[model samples]
Structures are given as structure tokens and as C-alpha cells.
Target: MEPLYQYAWLIPVFPLAGAMLVGLGLISFNRATNRLRQLLAVFIVSWLGASMVFSFAILWSQFHGHEPYQRTLEWAAAGNFHLMMGYTIDHLTALMLVVVTTVAFLVMIYTDGYMAHDPGYVRFYAYLSLFSSSMLGLVVSANLLQVYIFWELVGMCSYLLIGFWYDRKAAADACQKAFVTNRVGDFGLLLGMLGLYWATGTFDFDVMGANLETFVESGYLGAGMAAVFAVLVFLGPVAKSAQFPLHVWLPDAMEGPTPISALIHAATMVAAGVFLIARMYPVFEGIPVAMTVIAWTGAFTAFLGATIAITQNDIKKGLAYSTMSQLGYMVMAMGIGAYGAGLFHLMTHAYFKAMLFLCSGSVIHGMEAVVGHDPILAQDMRLMGGLRKFMPITSLTFLIGTLAICGIPPFAGFWSKDEILGSTFEVSPILWGIGWLTAGMTAFYMFRMYFSTFEGEFRGNEME
Candidate 1:
């Protein structure tokens, strides 16, 4: 039997193919029957299911001592300058593959039930498939150029999906906000990539790692120039991960559908930023000043997000800020040089945060059924009360997510979060103090949202 890594190319292909087919169906069959729609949903989901299985199998192979895999085909060349299309799968890519494919597969399944009555059913599926494919491509990219190509594609997919409900003015504006804000970061990313190439003469990460120190020692790459390059690259993650000033766009992104919120805020887009910093660890490690900047940025963002979440009344916006806070924790972990702990939190956060958003989606869905089409009234936690009787499973699952995010014992989040806190304490007790306070606030606001929505009497006005 062939090792699963050899078939890794199929992982991204399956989703891209599903997207093309569904997109063609949308154009060809405008008035698709219920049966036809169901079939399309099943077909696209099965494709992702296949990708998920393969992703897991590949991850399994990696754990069992499989070597990293790479396949490169030259795309362009001018003298010594060459561009290649390829993928590299090692520990990081393998982990991301499983995370992206698994969460995407589950989200699509949930969306089938959630969007059953919506007019954009087929289009939504197509966008999701495209989104998954772009992220998959990004994780497996072999070089900075490949990563950048897929990076922009991922951003474009986000823009499309965040505005999926284009008729809603809020959704339209939110997508634009996301797009423009990210462009600022992307320009920084492009400049950084060019600087790296100028210093090292290649975009391949492994090559850059091997040659960076030699270049710096030989006067080809100055220490100051290297630090500048690293910081410019850092801006990409600062914005993409919703760090500080760039974070304004994410809360507004709640205007989009909830699944997109879960995908972007939880696992894919925001996660990409931290993942980039992790991938480029060697360069940043050399610059103590750059590392300090990252650590403080993450520390401040964590405190800010938790404090803001405490003030939110809109359920989704509350969760959005919570995501921002949680992401800050992960980035702080990266900044503190707790690489393993940072990634541990990323994986744990992916599962629980995605669950929290989905649980919130279930609540909003139920509210719409009872309260009619009042988006504002439906999302207001002030109006939501005594919902557990109507949604036992969602409430229970949501509580589990609440406890997990709050870092309670025996939960996945506790172990990961504890690791980060321990690492933070060793680095700076001041930052650790902030992290500890943020943890307390996290518990308070999460339970506050929970009690407001799931306890006491139902306060919502019912539809006639």
C-alpha cells in the first residue's frame, strides 16, 4: 500500500474539484429541486470527507515516522531566478491539514441543515469548498511565493464568504472592511518577502533558514536590515491574526454568517498569522528586539480583547472578542518562544472555539424560528433567556465549550492554556499577570453570556 503522504496532492484537489462542480451546477441549474440540492450537498461533503480521511491518514503516517514529503515542478525561470510550484508536508503541514479538513467538513455538514431554507445554498457550498482548498494549499506551500499565492486566495475566499449574503448592507461593508484592512498587512508581507529574497536569493523556507546566518555574518545581510525585515514580516501576522489595531475588522465580521465566523476566527485566517510567525521562527529568534515587540503586542491584545468582550451585548460579537482574546494568547505564546505550547493552544482553540461559534449559530437559528426575522433582537443576549429547555444539546455543548475556553480542569484548553501561562511566567511575570487576569475575565464573560442566554425566563417576543 502506498503511504498516505504520496497522495497528499489529492487533499487539495478534492476540494477544488468539488468547488468547480458545484459552481457549474449553480450556473447550470438555477431552479434546482430539493432532491437535486440535497444531492449536491452530499456530493460536496463527500469530497471533503475524502479529504479529511486522507488528511488524518497523512497525519497518522507522520506520527508513525514517515519522512517529510516534497514535490516541486518549475513554473518560471530567468537566469538564476526560478519559480517553482510545490508542496512540503512535515509536522506543521500535517497538523494543519487535519485541522482544516476536519473543521471544514463538519462546518459544511452543519451548514447544510442551517442553510436549508436560504436561497444561496449551492453558492455557499461552492465558496466553502474554495475556502478549504485555499487554506489547504497555503499550509502545504513549499516556498514564500507559493504561500503568498495561496495566501491571497485565502483572503479572497474570506472576502467572498464574509459577504455571502450580499443583499445585507452590513455583510457587504464587513467584507470590504476585512479586505482593505488585510491589504495593509499584505503590502507589508510582500515587502518582507522581497527583502528576504534580496538577502538570501531564494524564497524556499528551508534554504532561507540554512543561509540566513551565513549571510548575516558575511556582511551580505546586516543585523539592522535583518531586524527590519523580520518586523515587516511580523506586520502580516499582526493584522491577519487580529492583533491590536488591525483587530477592528473582526468584530464587524459578525455580520457575515456564523460558520464563516467560526472558520475565519477559529482555525483558518487568524490561525494563519500565528502559523506564519511559527514558520519563520529562525529569523525572528535572531532579533531579540523583534521578539520583544511580538511579546508585548500579544500581551496587550489579550488584555484588550478580554476587557472588550466583557462589555458586549451581542452574542456573536462577544464571541468574536473572545476569539480575539484567545488568539492573543496563542500569539503571546509564540512571542514568548513557547512554540509547542502555542501550537497546542492553537489546536485546542480550534476545536472549542469552533464549537462555541456553532453553538451560538444554533441559538440564533432557533431564535429566528420563534422570533421571526429580527436579526438584532435575535442576537441580543439581553432578550435571550431560559433557552436550555428548547435546546438541551446545544446548551450542554455550549457549556462544555465555555468551560474549555475558561481553562477549567480536565479540558483540552486547560492543559494548553496552562502551558502558555507557565511559559509566560518564566519569561515575564508582568505579562503572566496580564494573562492570569485575562483568564479570570474570560471565565466571567463566558458564564455571563451563558447565564444570560440559557438560564431564567425567556424574554424574547414571539412571532404571531
Candidate 2:
């Protein structure tokens, strides 16, 4: 009997259908009824839940057989060239599918209680479903072109979700900033893809992976030319993963809903870069100079994020910078040829980061209930303290997340980060030192944010 992996394409389809159903409410479906809204939520949850289950099945097959399952279909044809669309079910895709769907499902479940009173409740869930589909599509994509297509779709959904509260100017501006910033990376990606196609006449990842050396040598390309193409491709990951100058958009992204922040921080948007680099590891492995650039870029970005995070008074923005720092760790691992370590960190970070962001949302929700949701005090850590007494469960979960990110022993971050640091030690002690120093700073800032938010006296206006 054939394995169930061949049906991997359906993973994204279910969420897409859920998004479509929720969207129909805008026209004639009369979604305002509480009973209908509850049913829609149930339907969306079932689809995402199914996707996660299917992902786990593929993972089981992968470990048992060590064989990737693939299914391809012709998307378009021109002359002798063919554009294909399909699914690739490998260990990486299987892991990513589970991570994306799992985070999305949890966030959706949490949103019901968190966003219950919002006027745009139905629209919120619709966008969440759309975001889930976009991310899963990217995960199962069989080719670079398909990845690019879904990459842009993920960006679009992020833009819509970030500016979800359109009446607020800050939300609107943050959305514009994020969209425009990503375009910088996308432009380079487009150029690199066009060059690759011009040189090789095919956009399929498997084909390109197998024939890259032959294709590059066919043009008799020099080191400089090869480096240029590699760097251009690297730009896409840098921007999406929030490395260095391209990383400024992520902190401002806190203007979005906290659940959306968790999605972006954990599995969907930012993880895209690290995942793509892992998928195309062969290309980078061939270029030594490109690898060096990636290592130093990650080092500097990690330190920069740690420093900024230490100074941030806004709880969500502090966590945002921490995510940037963690992503840098993943990128540095990839640069040093520790592909497994990079992916390991990505997986562990997904769990803890999602927990951290959700806990922050819970904190904000409780505070809003107490203070009546004032715009002036929203998400400001300066106005939040002694929350642990009021929200012990949220505080405990958030504390666990802080410990995990700090690389404390017996925690997920400790395991993954140790691998990255150990991998760096073999390559360059200087880089290892940088990674170590950043780890210390990560612990400091994470605790600083936690204490400032949950300890001491109430920081909010006492009269309120």
C-alpha cells in the first residue's frame, strides 16, 4: 500500500478552505450569529488539527524509511519549459508542517477567549486561517518558485493581520513598514531567481540542487560572479529571518495582535529564512566566502538584538528583539555547516517562542480586563508589575519560556543552543565567543523584561 505522504498537498488545502468559509461571512452568510461563529471556529480548528495529524504521519514514515515522498503536477507550459507545482514530503517539510500548524492551531484556540469582544472577531479568525495556509504551502513546496509564491502570500497575510486594527495609525504604519522592508529582500530574490533561470533554464529545486556545479561552470563563472549570486540569494533569508539592517521591521511588528506576533516569531514568517537556507544548503556549501559572510552577519545581528532588547520597556518589543537574537543563532549555525544544529534550534525555538508570545498575550488580556483596555497603557512594561500575583499560570509559563531562551540546563534552548555553540567552536573561537556573550545577554534581558513586568508593585496608575 502507498504511504499517506502523497496526499501532503491537502495539508494546505484544508486551511485555505477554512479561510474561504470564514470569508463568506462578509457577504451573505450572516456570520454575526453567535452559534454560526462558534461553528466556524470549530470548522477552522478541525482543518488545522487534521493538518497537524497528517504531518505527524509523514514524520513517522520518514524516520522509519528514510525516504522522502514527492508528488508533482504540471502548473504551466511554454514551448519546451514546464512550471511545476507539487509537494515534497521530507524530514524538513514534515517538521515544518507540524510546527506551523501546531502554533497556528494553538493560537486560534487562544484567540477565541482573547479576542471574544473585538468587533472584527470573524475577520480575525479568517486571517489566521489564511496565514496558516500560506505557511503550510511554503513548507510543502517542491520548488524555489513555489516557495517564492507562498513567501509573498505569507507577507500579504502578515500585512493584513498587522494592520488588523486599521483605525489605529500606528498599526497602519507598522504594516506598511513591514511590507516595504520585506520588498528589499524580495527584489534580490527575484533577481537571483531570474539569473538562476537564465543560467539553468529550470526553477525546480531538486534539478538545480543536482546540477548546480555543472550549471554554474557552464557559464565559466568566476569567484566574484558566484559570490554575487550567493549573496543575492542570502538577502532573501536575511530580510525574512530578520538579520541586521533588514531586521528593524520585526520589533515594530508588535503593533499587531499578540497571537500574530507568536505566529511570526515562532513558525511562520521569520523561520522561513532559516528553513530555506537549510533546504538549499548545497548551494551555500559550495561557496566558502558566502558562508563566512553569513557567520559574521549572524554574530553582529545577535549581539545587536540582545543589546536592544535589554533597553526596551515594552514587553512585546523586548520579546521581539529576543526572537531576532535567536534567529541569528540559527543562521550562524547554518553558516558554520551545522545544518542539523540550525534546524534543531529552529524546532526548539518554535516551541518556547510560541509559549512566550502567548503568555505575553495572556498578560495583556488580564491587564486590559483590569484597566479597561487603555491605548495609553497598552503593552508597556513600565505600567505592568506584580502581575504574577494576579496571573500565576501565565507568569509560570512565561517564566519557563524565559528559562528556556536563556539556555538554562535541562531545557530545550540549552540543548539546541549548546549544539550551535559547540558547532561554532570547531569553526572559529572568535565566533564562539560572540555566541557565548550573546547567550549571557539573552539571559539578562529576558529576565529583566520578566521581572519588570511581573515583580514589585503595580506600575499602572493606582487610581485606575
Candidate 3:
């Protein structure tokens, strides 16, 4: 590992500092004074943007696929067993740092336009900064224990951002729901960590991969026990990523501000789940049962999410379900042993999905000014039409995002989806069939939302 790789630990520091400065003690920024909010935004955008630049520097300096390396500050140890605070940088972590930081910095910029008038604007930036820190930390965590710690941090940030407008009952409830549902998965993940420790007495991913035989042949863990550990670990991603039955809370998350929606759905919250699986793939591969379950579960979630999206009239909610469906594809690809395919989709999906959600924010922002500031009425596609005539740029960009997610030809999604499906066809033609069907449904529902919101005459009541 190069000396420059040691700085990976610093990528999250600026944001945490910005969060503390913006919050300045976890209370409101002098209760809605715009100047303080403005100042805080400057601090955050400066710090987070700097962090992004620093991360890109790491990417540039460490672009070569190097052996795994770590920088640690020991936290605890029981003789031979150890716990530490640190980062693990490898090829994957380098790629993810670039993706997470890039999207986060852009979201901060977009928040300026979308959240300027809100009273919690200062605190919102505070939370956004912290969210970036948590996610970047999660990407480079050295072990399952560090993963859990930063995983919970990101989840906390999600709760705060989702419930940013706490005065609204829906926002408050959605935050609680997202938190509690994720807890169910987090507990399982914790148990998985504990089980791994019991079997091999280590928290480092590299150490665990080196000792898989000791876990099995040493008689400390049976094959079935290994599978259970893998399954328990996988449960976290399922809930966090909003797969199948645990997916109910995602749509309700629209109660938050829309850039936060992009933050959660596209860049940070849900993406963390898939990233974990990819990071842990070496361990996950030892258990066939875990892989089979993950593959089928992801396939079903993709299909189910697309179908429900077909009926949604709320624009953000529709995009939320689309995220759920897209995440499913990533998980399914990983399950079927298409590691590169899964991650390729994850990287591409982050770009396009964030664009789609931000464009939704732009639409809502314009409608609020036009329709007297009721978000519910503004976001309801039943009342929206012919928006392309007025907001042509947002409409055109949004259509490109829609096409990308729909796997249309010559778009980012088409290449990734084809790769996942190609990998799936080799693993299971039946699953590939399901994936293709979901892709068609994705195109249908997306176009449905697009036309209803931008093509027809305004279905909204005459407010002028």
C-alpha cells in the first residue's frame, strides 16, 4: 500500500467537523435565522466539497488495485482478540469513496436551492454533512465491527434527515419507521459479527478470509453454522436495502425533503446494504444457502417493487419504489456470483437515480411556488401535467434518468442491467427471465409517471 492510502481515514473528518460546527451543540441554529443558516451552509459546502476533492486525490493516487491495507487505532483487546477504529482501503473502497463523496457533494449543492426557505435549513446541512461522514466511513471500514458502527451512524443520519421536518406528523412517523425497521436488520448483523468472533476470534475482513479453514476444519463452526452466520449478516442488507416484505417504509420516506430523498435512496442509506454484501462476498461465497436465498429474494423484490410502482401517483413515492426495485437487481447479481456486475449497476444507479430524485425535487420546488406551497398537492401527479412546457430542462433531464433506469438502449442502465442479466442467464435462466420482466415493468411504470406528470393537460384545479 502506498503512503497516500493512509489518508483514506481522513475523508470523513471534514464532514463530521462541519456537522459539529453547523449544529454548534445539537440545537437549532439560533432558531431559523437565515444568516446563521447561510453561514452554516458555507461551512458545510466548503468542508464537504473539500472532502470530495481529497477523496478524489486518494482515488487518483491509489487507482491501481493494491493489496488490502489498514490504519488503526486500537480500541480494545482481550489478549489475542482485538478491536480498533480504522479504515480498510482496497480497490473496491477506492471506487466507492469516489462514488459516495461525489454524490454527497452534489446533494449538498442541490440542497442550497431546495432547502433555502425551510426553517431547519441549517440543521439539514448539518445532518447532510454527518451523513456523508458516516457513509464514507462505512465504505472503508476494516472489519464487521467497524461496519456495524458506521452502519448505525448512517442509519441515524437517515433518521434525522428523514424527519428533518419534525413538525409534520408524516415526517416524524417515517423517521421512526425507517429507524425501527432497520433495527431489525441491524440486530441480525450484530449477531453475525458475534458469531464470527466466536468462531475465529477476529473482526478484520482480511483476517477472516485467511482463516475460513480454521473456522470450518478446526471444529469451531460447522458448515450449517457458517451458513447461518452468512444469512444473519445478509438480513441487514435486506432490511436496509428495503427488500421485499421489509420494504414498506421506503415510500413513506417521501415525507422528508426531496434532496434528502436522493441522499437516502440513491447515494447513502440503501446503497450501504449492497456495498456491505460486496465487501463481504469472499465470506458469503462459502455458504451456498446464503447465496441462493439472496438471489431469489432479490429477484422477487425487484419484480414486486416494479409492480407496485405501476400504481403509485405520488412522484417521489414512485421513484422510491423504483430505487427499491433497482437495489434488488444489484443484490440479485451479487447472489448469482456476478460481483462486477452488481457493483457496476450500483455505481451507475447512484448517478442516474440521484439525478431522477433531484429532478423530482426541482419539479416540486417549482410547483410549490406556483401552487401556494402545499407539497402534498404539488407532488401528486394527478394534479400535475404539461410541466415540460414550463420546466423544460428538468423535464428533459428527468426523462433521461427515467430512460436510464428503464434499461433503454444507449443509456447507463442498459449496459449494467444487461451485464446482470447476462450473468444471471449463466447461473439460472429462470431468474434471468424474472429480471427481464421486471425491466419491462420498470419502463412501463416510469413512463406512466412521466406522461401523467408532464405530457397531458394540467389535471390540477384552477388556482389562478
Candidate 2 residue pairs in clash (backbone atoms < 3 Å) = none
- Compared with the true structure, what per-residue lDDT tens digits does model 1 show for residues 166-270? 999988999999999999988998999899888888888878766777887888778788878878888888888999888988998898888888888877898
TM-score of each: 0.97, 0.96, 0.96
The lowest-lDDT stretch of 10 consecutive residues in candidate 2 is 26-35
lDDT of each: 0.89, 0.87, 0.87
Model 2, position 204: C-alpha lDDT score:
73
Whichever of 1 and 3 has more TM-score, that candidate is 1
**Local accuracy of candidate 2 as per-residue lDDT tens digits, 1-464:** 15586567889999999888778765665546334776778888898999988878877777787677778899999899898888888888978888888888998999888778787777888899999999999998888899999999998999999999989999999999999999999898888777666655677765664466665566655656666777788889999999998998998899988889999999999999998888777677777888888888888899899999999987889999999999999999999999999999999999899999999998888777766676446678888899899989888999999999999989999999999999999999999999999999999999998898889998777744
Candidate 3 off by > 4 Å: 1-3, 25-34, 65-67, 217-220, 462-464
Query: Model 1: how large is the Cα RMSD against the reference?
Result: 1.7
Error of 2 at 115 (Å): 0.5
Cα error, residue 443 of model 1, in Å, equals: 0.8
- Report backbone clashes per prediction: 0, 0, 0
lDDT of 2: 0.87
